[model samples]
Target: MKLQSTLVFSNELPPVKKLGEEILLIYDQILAQKSPSFGKWAKGISLKYPVKAGEHLKDIEQFPRHIKAITKLTEQTSVKKLTVVVVGGGSVGDFGGFVASILKRGVRLINIPSTWLAAIDSAHGGKTALNVGGAKNQIGTFYPADQIIMVRTVLMAQPEARAFEGFGELIKISLIEGGKLWSSLAKEKQINSKTLWKYLEAAVHAKYKVVAKDPHEKKGIRHVLNLGHTIGHVLESHYELPHGIAINYGLNFALRFSVQKKVMKPAEASRLFGEPVMGFLLSPLRDDLISVKSSDLAEYRRLLLSDKKKTKAATLRFVFVKKPGKTVIQEVTVDDLLIELCRQREEELHG
Candidate 1:
């Protein structure tokens, strides 16, 4: 499945105007209250599947119930002309995208990302997923939406706290692409929704560049995208942290590990962190704020192994940064990650 195209519009919802006659809108219920025009835009929608939207929404056990409801809701509509327009954050997009991919054996799908996190990262990827028990993204598909529409009002409507969430992916992309994005972004005095909007295009482009290289992830090229995601997913599942916030810590861990393992020059690592912007994104995480027992270490390892992207029996092709725009992938085991986690936690306590 080739990703069709992305339209990043400011203060407009232009793509929704041309939606197919039989539109099956799977939206976050929160949007109805948050977005002023959400109701108006949803006026003529054939079927509206309003979801709560979160990691819980991706539970595999709950999936059959959701799909069954959607099946009944769309039974009367013409599947050929049906379009699944998903409007929400990442989780809603994942659940809706998965629904659209399998609904009537694949239908035209569109995404109207309502959160900066979704607008900047997850919504564009074409990867749909559902979780098994507590494990994240265990089952999924590569179903790219036909179009991705980024509406300013909807995105801007998010709570200010949500900007912190968006920043993780925003910063991750900049660091991955490095060069100009890193230089300019690092100079910012403050990061807010506007800052996120300004770099939205570049971040999305950076992600697409990686995805295009290994769209199906058959080649190892795309594994670089998992820079912070390995430990990030574990923290998100174990600590119940927001995905973006968990990634912020995960990115920090990866950068430090890169330097500690002698894979990246200390000078290069210092230069990357010396940027004023790193101060906000690299602040101490909850892991540092709290103490970890051996039981916690065992639990963390269990969650880490459940990441679904491990290569060998207990190894992962962890992404390491050599410098801005330069990254290397190396085979790492669970024990290596555990040791680093403990070492990092100890350092946080001391310093």
Candidate 2:
């Protein structure tokens, strides 16, 4: 399937003046301080909305006020020629993409992701989302961007530690699209800007391949992309871990669960874990993060139910890997997930 958005790579931010005569720039406010060039460029825009990037920025209750302000900001601009350029990391991309999708019933959207996480994952999927009542992604639209520009300088400007946050998605896609992508990534010894940049193109294309097959995520084929997100989200919301860091733990949990369920052969699991890149999956703070107590079961269950991917009252389609590139989905109840979480926590504690 052909990708809806045109993908471009550049060493620096492109001239947004040429994108449209009337442009509404929705960007992370932090970029003004983080990137001088971005700050200078933003000053020239006639209509721009600078936003704080995070889960709170996606709160649905805040949407009305945001839209009203944006409406007033673009009141005189011609809708036909209006373009929304989003610049930021995942949460910013999510908020901006949601705004672009609804503003004037949609506009030409271009995403210039400033962080590796957005550039590699969120920026490509065209999944715009907003949270409601503290539940993540409760309301959203499948509004693909008109263009996705990955600026090298913008991404590299992020702190080196941010590379660890992007590694989860990078490894997740490589594992799902296994063969050359997996083989090459598995041998890498470092998780840094250079390594991420080297694999960024392949990782984005790998995601588009899955999304193209099931663009709307109606078909279960796209569920493969949720490899580590299930438990990952739980860890993220509960522990307040960075999305990528939480996903790293989530991927670790899923791999162990797959082996326990006999979905993946022990030899295969062993081989995959033995890879050099796999070492980066577990942070030094794993014990602090993965130690879920029995008292926390109620909260964990609540999070699992709140998941948008839940199929019935308490069951969700969980993605399990049999091997790199081969995954299986199974419907597991909330209780089932909690039991597994406790079991994993125990195993981590003892061994």
Candidate 3:
């Protein structure tokens, strides 16, 4: 269960958590060293650190409120041929990438992700999204970053909750891309910066396998990565849960549901989510289950209708489970789907 240091380059960058407010200056140093390598890729780079730090980590829902402030701060600076901007975390990257994508028809993006959630999952993916009204990530564009620089230092400063929040996404990745790597992580006692960086590489490779094969999500291959995201997104929109936490809960619920449907065996589901790893156990039960009735289902349907993944036909496409490392994208009716959601609510209450 011991993660290897050889698989990860420990000296590439300092730990991000320890940097704090000096992150901007630290990044300036990184840019100075890489100036030659990024010569053609970027004209100039700048860090727009948040003045009034938001309550939690940056999120897409808070974009509009801060966009004007952000715009004012960076507006006076002369435009470089290629401007590379660094944002704090996932939401920052999402909105930052979206803005960069549309600025003067598009500009280069260089992300320096700070959170474990951002480092391991959201930051690398080409997807950028923002919330609109009551739905989650209702507005977004598909845009890729020019480069993403990961410094292990950030993980050290990350709160324990966020570290575990990121761990949830990592666990999901392991379930899909299972091997000795996954098993080792599932049993690790102390997940250190070195171990986090090690799996970050593996998770990226695993995700790349799916995204490369189906970059646009037109094929069902990439959709499998959304295994728990279906119910997960709805929960996020309805409750005020953080994105990663909501997804963790959704993943647990989906896994349990899959067992109920006989789509996967209990033993297999248990192994991936059975025991707690680093005090972050993905339980098969929900503590605060909220039931949505037939009327509430209508509202839920409205949110689904507005989902970015929807098409003109507007059918609910589920990234449901078939087995470990195997998933199927099935289109389900809203009514039928709500029934399943209600069942999940009931299960959460009794269990």
Top candidate when judged by TM-score against the true structure = 2
Q: Once superposed on the true structure, which residue ranges of model 2 sit more than 4 Å away at CA?
A: 1-3, 283-288, 307-313, 349-351
- What is the per-residue lDDT of model 2 for residues 1-351, given as tens digits with 9 covering 90 to 100? 224799998898888677778899999999999989888888888788999988889999898999999999998887789999999998989999888888888888899999988988998878989998987788998889988999898898899999989998999999889889999999999889999999999999999999999888888788888999888988888888898988888888888889988999999989999999998887322466555566677777778887356544567888888998888899878777778877776676676
Candidate 1 worst ten-residue window by lDDT: 282-291
Error of 1 at 7 (Å): 3.3
Candidate 1, residue 216: how far the Cα is off, in Å: 1.0
Note the residue pairs that clash in candidate 1.
none
CA lDDT of each prediction against the hidden true structure: 0.84, 0.86, 0.60
lDDT of 3 by residue, 1-351 (tens): 011111232333433432232112112223323334333222322444342222222355565565665455556544444454554567667766676666546655656666777777777657777665544466677776756666565445555656666767886787677675567777777655556767887887777767777665676677778867776777677666676777777677666667766777777766655545524644423554545666667666766665445543556666656555676566766655667777777766775
The order by descending lDDT is 2, 1, 3
lDDT top scorer: 2
Off by over 4 Å in 1: 283-287, 307-313, 349-351
Per-model TM values vs. the true structure: 0.91, 0.92, 0.70
Worst 10 residues of 2 by lDDT: 283-292
Task: Compose the digit string of candidate 1's lDDT tens values, residues 1-351.
Answer: 555455656576654558777888999998888877877777657578899988899999998899999999999878788989999999999999999999999988889899998899889868999999876788999999888888888888899889988999988888899888889998887888989888888888898988887778888887787889888888777777888988998898899999999988988878878888888765334345423678877787777776456443588789999888998999889889888887887777686
Ranking by TM-score: 2, 1, 3
